[model samples]
Target: MAKPIARKTSRGADRMETTLNNKVLTEIWGADQGVGLRVKQAALVVLGIAILAVAAKIKVPMWPVPITMGTFAVLSIGAAYGARLGLVTILGYMIVGAIGFDVFAGSSAEKFGLTYMMGGTGGYLVGYVLATFALGLLARRGWDRSFVWMALAMLIGNVLIYVPGLIWLGQLYGWDQPILQWGLTPFLIGDALKLVLAAVILPAVWSFVGKART
Candidate 1:
């Protein structure tokens, strides 16, 4: 009886020691953690942004604007990073492009012009930031796994990006109807495909990554 009690005491003490150690370590690293995490996050966002531009280069020209894989990166990054970080990353990319960097689609280093980069799909670019917020909202609510929910997530993302994009495109063409003609009509099918693909892949990627983390 004494032996069992002693053993139980030993186990309890060990568990307590472990918990204390964990708490201490967490406290020690907590401040650095926020900074480190932000740095790491920014790096990932930059990579995602670069990938967006690279994807555009792989475009298969179709209509008003060429269909590019950039949209995939846009939608995927949001679902992957959640709302806040996703928005930050895409917004960071836009800021970089806006500040006269050739980081946007078709803005070759040789040409290196900001006009095309900021003018053509600028609305969509801004919209991408909004999409990230929308996508992140649904994903955090545990809708990341459902196809219907994920599809809705992507659809909302597209709408967020496209609507403002259409308005801007309309402005550019100096015609109110340019949105219907240039923005929405031209990219409907392609955007739908991109949304479907994002919806399919985001949950799987997150799930796989989650399993690894666990």
Candidate 2:
């Protein structure tokens, strides 16, 4: 009697997606799954706001200019948290600042709140939202998983931040003023270093996660 041949199923037939599409660090961690959707989102937003606050004050000693980790936090959180959550987190941070919380690097008790936000850093704040969205979007495409792609994503994110920042400085001060010197040139070294750091960190984190998963 001839036995019927058995068929071999495809590899990982029941496994989750192996590719990095639509999956971010937060989703992989599944921390939000422990609570309701709104609750998880709210908690993440609060956590993000706190992170931004702390990052705003952290200064790494470097050449030419000290590197503030605020922008780095903004970009990293956006990539890790995804677009919608990142946007809400940034808005929440802004609201906290607007209500006079001294949550900005350049703001103080005497000069905090809306008055401070509407000053020099206002345009950069707007850029924060845009750059967050851009980073989130790029992360969705798996750019955060590789050194080259993550570096490119960070570069794009920085550009998104700087363009509006420079424009705001020009409009706030004047075109004849040294807008480039005041807002762009001096910070290039710090930004470049941060960019390299981010490029290294994100990919390394992903690699660590990959190894842990196996």
Candidate 3:
């Protein structure tokens, strides 16, 4: 009787491990099961927020909106964390910024807290959340495995960010404000570079992971 129970327990453990391995790559790579998983996930959220803060600070000044690596970080985190955790992580970052942390692109005494969130770049920030969600969904679908598919996924995420951003800019400055020049054109080249880099990096990482697993 004791031996049968032990064999059953072992089988259950094996099943749990199999389930974890079959999940999205990020979850498989970063998470674990049982009692410690929640704590591990919380730590991942904090780390994601920290990464966003650092990326926000690496910017090139431009009119209306400064070009920043924040977008790149957002998409990358999504692709690496899956939908639920990715959304949680991004929302955590936003909440931190909203509560007056100096985590935004150009934090200053004059521009912090909710006031900054409601500024010209506010839409872009919201877009980051949406884009991250989208990318996370794609990542769960295993879109990150191929370079072409990953590129398309990243491109979609990039476009998602601009949509809300442009709309908000239009509303703030009105139709005659040349919103495109200020909000979109300046960042085209930079965004393209980021997109390509992300596309390349994700597929390469997936390849490396495959190699390591084998």
Candidate models: Cα lDDT each: 0.69, 0.87, 0.85
Give per-model TM-scores: 0.72, 0.90, 0.85
In model 2, state the lDDT of residue 132: 93
Candidate 1's C-alpha runs over 4 A off are: 1-36, 61-66, 109-114, 176-178, 209-214
Which candidate wins on lDDT? 2
lDDT of 1 by residue, 25-71 (tens): 11222233677866776677778778766776678766566787777
Q: lDDT at 123 for candidate 1? A: 79
Model 2 poorest 10 in a row by lDDT: 1-10
**Top TM-score prediction, candidate number:** 2
**lDDT per residue (tens digit) for residues 5-48 in model 3:** 99998897777656644455556654488757888898899999
Q: What is the alpha-carbon lDDT for the whole of candidate 2? A: 0.87
- Clashes by residue pair, model 3: none
Global fold similarity of model 2 (TM-score): 0.90
Which residue pairs clash within candidate 1?
A: none
RMSD of each: 7.3, 3.6, 6.0
Worst 10 residues of 3 by lDDT: 17-26
Kindly report which residue stretches of model 3 are placed more than 4 angstroms away from their true locations once superposed.
1-22, 60-66
Q: Report lDDT (Cα) of residue 32, candidate 3.
A: 81
